[model samples]
Target chain A: MRDAYHDELRALTGRLVEMTRLVRSAMSRATTALLDSDLPLAESVISRDKDVNQLCEEIETSIFGLMATQQPVAVDLRTVITALRMAADLERMGDLAVHVAKIARMRHPDSAVPAEIRDSILEMGQIAERLVTKTGSCILTQNAELAQELEQDDDHMDRLHRRLFRMLLSESWEHGIEPAIDITLIGRYYERYADHAVRVAQDVVYMVTGSRVGE
Target chain B: MRDAYHDELRALTGRLVEMTRLVRSAMSRATTALLDSDLPLAESVISRDKDVNQLCEEIETSIFGLMATQQPVAVDLRTVITALRMAADLERMGDLAVHVAKIARMRHPDSAVPAEIRDSILEMGQIAERLVTKTGSCILTQNAELAQELEQDDDHMDRLHRRLFRMLLSESWEHGIEPAIDITLIGRYYERYADHAVRVAQDVVYMVTGSRVGE
Candidate 1:
């Protein structure tokens, strides 16, 4: 019985890593769709969010089952509870990606990225993907050091986020209000995606070390 | 020992309700700050958020202690877990309010809401406070019926959110890009605040009925 319980806990970790992979893909494709104005790609990102939601639900169910039967104690209990928090963060990351995709759909056939701001948005997207990838690795490897790396990536994301605003507010901005609004929201989506990814990494650190990062 | 466990559970509910009250006050003052350009009020809202965070930490510590000592099963297990989820949602709502407060601080001495869109923003703030008030009641009473009301309030918030964008994009919008950007982010903060409140209510419903609403 104890062996099965540990196996179930391992399976829970596997599912969380899977969630990170899906969210990463969603963010990657959503970025492409935004930059290229590919309607189909945007639609795919939006539709596949359900898969992330389902995985989160599965994780919750398994954690509840584990708690009810095994009554996980000490580090094991911390692991399951931390898994629940990580899954929630990962699910929100998926939603943030969809929010980005929806911007692509809203402005279909017209790329949301203005020429001057394109590089910033592209960098933000790249940072988002990098953060989530690291988040996945952190969850799978339980590497507290790798988790520490996510904070630096999140700082880079924040710098890119501020740069995007600078571009928007610069005197050279010719994109007008509509695109500015889109970019403001799109920048927000990427920043929030990075934040959630960082949160998942934090949860991993907490699970492994039983201590929170930066807290 | 069982009686002590149940008392802790009741205390958990009290803490959640206290969180809701803190979040509600935060939003209320945040809205006034945004509308009145009240820097002190905004600063107050921002500083008070740590209080909310501290309460959440206390709740988590108490829940962990309860789970370890009692090994609560079945409905009690669900109750403790749901309380954790509700605390998280409430904490996020506090952050969202702080986001709104920050916008007010950013534009201090100049109101963030333009005169034309002021009413809609005010209404959004009112709805946010209402939703959280009901959320507090739902947690205290475990009233599934009252929990259902939060969905309708959230729908109203969504409608107001849409209305905000329409005003910003309208031909008569004379505020230009800077204020438009501020309003865009302000609108998003309130919308997300409402979404979190609704989630708390949903968790309350699930805690009471052992089922989810709108799922």
Candidate 2:
């Protein structure tokens, strides 16, 4: 029975890592869709979000079942609770990616990324992908140190986010209000995506060390 | 011992209700600050957010203690878990309020809201207040039926969100990129605040009925 309980916990970890993969793919494709105005890719990212939601539901169900039957205590109980949080963060990350894709779809043939800020958006997307990839590694390995690195990546994303704003507000900006609005929202989505990835990594650290990072 | 455990559960509900009050007050002050360009009010909202965070931490500690010692199962287990989730949602609502307040502070003496969209922002703030006030009632009463009302309020919020965008994107918008950017982010903050309030109410429904509202 004890072995079964541990096995169930391990299975929960695997599902969380899988969640990271799905969201990472979603953001990656969503970025390309935004940059290239690829309608097909944007549609794919939006439609595939349900899979992430379904996986989150699965994780919730498993955690409830494990708790009711096993009544995991101490560190084990914390592990399950933290897993629930990580799943939620990953689910939200998937939604953020879809938001980015929808922006790409909204503009359709017209790219949302104005040429002036296109490089910044691309870098933001890359940072989002990198953050989630590292999040998955942290979850899989329970490496508290690796989780610490996500904070630095998130800071870099924030810097890029600010740069995008500067470009929008710059004297040379000729894109008018529509593109500015789009870029503002798009920047928010990428920054939020990075924040959620950092949260998932923080949860990994908490699950491993039983102490919150930076606190 | 059972009585003591149940008492702790009741205390948990009280703390969640307290969280609702804190966030509701925050949003109210934040909205007034935004509309009036009241720096002191905005500063108060920003500083008081720490109180919300502290309350959330207290609730978490209590839940963790209860889970470790009581090993509550069945409905009791679900109640504690749901309380944790509600606390998180409420905590996030507080952050969103601070976001609104910060914008208000940033624009100090110069209103972040323009005359054209002022009515819309005012209405959004009222709806935000209404939604959170109802959220508090739902938590206190655990009325699943009352929880259903939040969905409508959220729908109202969505409409207001769309209206704000329309105003921003309208041909008559002469506020340039800076104020447009400010309003875009501010609208997002209020909409997200309402969304979080709805989520807290949904958790109330789930806690009482053992089933999700929309699912």
Give the poorly placed runs of model 2, Cα more than 4 Å off: none
Q: Pull out the clashing pairs in model 1.
A: none
Q: After superposition, how far is residue A3 of candidate 2 from its true place, in Å?
A: 0.4
lDDT of 2 at B192: 90
Worst window of 10 by summed lDDT in candidate 2 chain A: A206-215
Model 1 interface CAPRI class: high
Ten-residue stretch with the least lDDT total in model 2 chain B: B206-215
* Lowest lDDT block of 10, candidate 1 chain A: A206-215
Docking class of 2: high
**Share of native interface contacts recovered by each model:** 0.71, 0.91
Q: Stretches of candidate 1 above 4 Å error?
A: none
| Residue-wise C-alpha lDDT for candidate 2, range A148-200, written one tens digit per residue | 89999999999999998899989999989999999999999999999999999
Per-candidate DockQ versus the true complex? 0.84, 0.93
TM-score of each: 0.99, 0.99
